[model samples]
Target chain A: MNYFDAQTWIGGWPFSFQPAHRAATLARALRGEGIGRALVSPLDAVFAPEPTPANRALLRSCRTLRNLLPVPVINPALANWREQLAVVARDRSVRAIRILPNYHNYALTSSEVEAFVSEIQGRSLRLVISMRLIDERHEYFAMRLTGVPTGQLDRFLERHPDMPVLASGLYRTDLLSLLPRHPNLLADLSFAEWFDIVDQLVRRLGARQLAFASHTPFLITAAALAKLGQVGIGATDLTSIAHRNLERFLKT
Target chain B: MKEDGRGRAEAAELIAEAARFGIEHLVALGDVLVYGRRPAAEQVREINDDTAWLVQTFPGKVSGFCYLNPVLGEREVWREVERCLGWGARGIKLEIANNARDRCMQPVMAAAQAHGLVVLQHAWSMTQIRQRSYHTDPEDAALLAGRHPEVRIVMAHLTGCGIRGILAAKPHPNLFVDTSGAAPEAGILERAVDELGPERILYGSDVPVRDFRVAIARVTGSSLDAETRRRILFENARRLLKLP
Candidate 1:
């Protein structure tokens, strides 16, 4: 099955073993997992003070890899947030900007985000908020970062109610709670899990609100995809989840 | 009897769902401890009876594992095990009634060794959670395996145990880990194969609670070779369960 994965990362992690680190390696790995196209970001951007360098590096690495679309990370908390946006704008492959609010140590309610969202909207780029990279409970002892609270996300949506935001790494509960209040919000299935997750989600929220995300390298690609299978949902819904929704999200 | 009223799928439904991924047989481990850690003997009996009913209902499709709370002491543990075995329970299931390192596990392991039954213990990496007192951390499970060398032990929840759990099982040939519980973390199964070899691993769905697709994909989607993947998914469980 061909998939347009909305959530994925490239570059090395601080831990011991990583499935694929470099852009080419990650692209090949994604292809092996049947991901036809993926929105890729640099892992280094999450830690760096300014994401411009990492974002530039991501653009450079994914230059030849057509399947990998560079989604540069922009830390709005940093003074050089505009520069990061400028760097991504210079790269034609970049279609969206990813924000790590928790890792960057800023609440979604902050004026910084308000200005950042406005700027991103002005540039005609979509916004992807990474709620978290890993489960907080399993986070490295030294770096115990919590996910962006549902309340903050709700409030953030209230401010920019019409903004087409794609949030990654949200739990099932988080997705459900946020779904009703924020109709403009879209989520990826990378970090969510439950018995018959797709069925549950489709029953509650329509297929349009959901997209496929492998959370590759950090999460097993096949494992995330398999959740899509054996879910007892319709063929059209499955197709929508696996690729169409994501394709539409990127296009719009 | 109070149903969850949630319209949970039945065994036939589950089997059909699993069959999509080529899973023909399932090991039903009952509710384990529906009444919490130190369940009354009757509660244990009821849970096992339900498990036996599932085994009977599904016939060739399901295997039963008797749940025991060893904290109820040796007599209770042995009696329940005997009763469940009479109903065709092929193994023993131990939950968080106590840590594997506790003295209570002696009777549990002893009964398993005597009956030639596989002991499936719930375990996770307790480094951050710090619940090793009642919970079986990977280290405590490793200790349990060290103490009972003759008994074959299966530590449940490969993702929860993580790399620490794989390393914990490295020294004991009789000890194995099951790929159950939690979301599939990349590089974990590969590391498990690297550290413990393919034979020491088994595929587990933690079904009804976990989706069969996700659990199976954890092994199928890993970086392990086809043979190693086949071993973990089918061959190892077959050997452990003595299935033809």
Candidate 2:
């Protein structure tokens, strides 16, 4: 199966030893798990005061690696977010721009986010809002970040009903609550887990709303693949979730 | 009879599904949260009876673990432990009824020590929640293991415990950590193996609540060698439960 991971990161995460620290290593690892292409982000960007350098570094690293698509982090809270967005938008391979509301210390409901969304929509670029990269409870003792509030996300989704957004790192409950009301929202299967997760989600929200996400270097890539492969969903639903849905979502 | 039939069918399906993933045995830890954290003695018995039913019905395929609320006093704890032992419970499962460091756990730990039953304690890092009074932190579980060196204890939810939990488990040889709970974060299973060795790490699904395939992949997908994976996935658990 040619899986297109909607969520994955490369670069050192200070808290834990991220195995695939380079794009090539991550690409090789994902390929071993049958993931042909992955939408890549930078782990260093999550903790940086300004994400431009990390985003630049990611684009540089992924330049030669065709299967690794760069998804640069945009911190609208920073003064130079437009410049950051412009730099990444110049790259045709850059299909989506991700924002870390909790890490960047910005409210999803902030005026800056409204403008950022407007700019992203204007440029015809997709938006990927990361709910969290690591599980909040288990983060480093000093770091006290939490997943972006689902309430705020609901409001954001409500505000930008026309802008299609991919919310990564959502728990199963979050997905169930958010996906039903927001037709513009799509979720990655990085953090959403249950016994029969794929089948259950497909039954409730339809397969079109779900996409494959490894959350690699932070989460076990094979675990995500296992969730998708072992479920009893039909070939078409599986195909849609594996790559097709994400493909459509990015194109739109 | 109708409920029993439905339950049997469910159990059979579970076993068959698990078999597809090469799982031969399951440790039935009763719905630990069904009656809330501090379950009454009757509620404890009710949960155990359900687990007992699965054990009795499935025999070798399923092993029963007596779920206990440590706050339920010595008399009730002893009575339930004896009753569960009579029905062939291989271990005692503890949830958030009381902290592992609490005075209430003495009788419960004593019962397991006396009966030669392994204890699986629900432990997570309490740094974020701050509910250590009732919830078992990795430190609390490790302390419990330190207190009773005779009884083997499994600290559940390795991901929740995180790296701090791994270090806390280091000193106590009697303490083992299971690869379960939360998301299967990359490198945690590997870290556990590095710090505690593969023999002390057990593969746990946290199933019905967690996906079986994903849980298995947490170990299988790790960078560990085939031998270490085998130890974590099957051999260690088999040895811990003394399964024939």
Using DockQ as the measure, the top candidate is 2
- Each prediction's Cα RMSD? 2.5, 2.3
The DockQ-derived docking category for candidate 2 is medium
- Cα shift from native, residue A19, model 2 (Å): 1.8
TM-score per model over all chains: 0.94, 0.97
Q: Could you list the chain B TM-scores for each candidate?
A: 0.94, 0.95
Steric clash pairs (candidate 1) = none
Question: How well docked is model 2, in DockQ terms?
Answer: 0.80
DockQ each: 0.63, 0.80
**Least accurate 10 contiguous residues by lDDT in model 1 chain A:** A12-21
Worst 10 residues of 2 chain A by lDDT: A12-21
Which segments of model 1 are wrong by more than 4 Å?
A: B1-9
Worst 10 residues of 1 chain B by lDDT: B1-10
Per-residue C-alpha lDDT of model 2 across residues A103-142, encoded as one tens digit per residue? 8899999999999999998898999999988888877778
Per-residue error at B153 for model 2, in Å? 0.7
Displacement of residue B37 (Cα, Å) in model 2 is 0.9
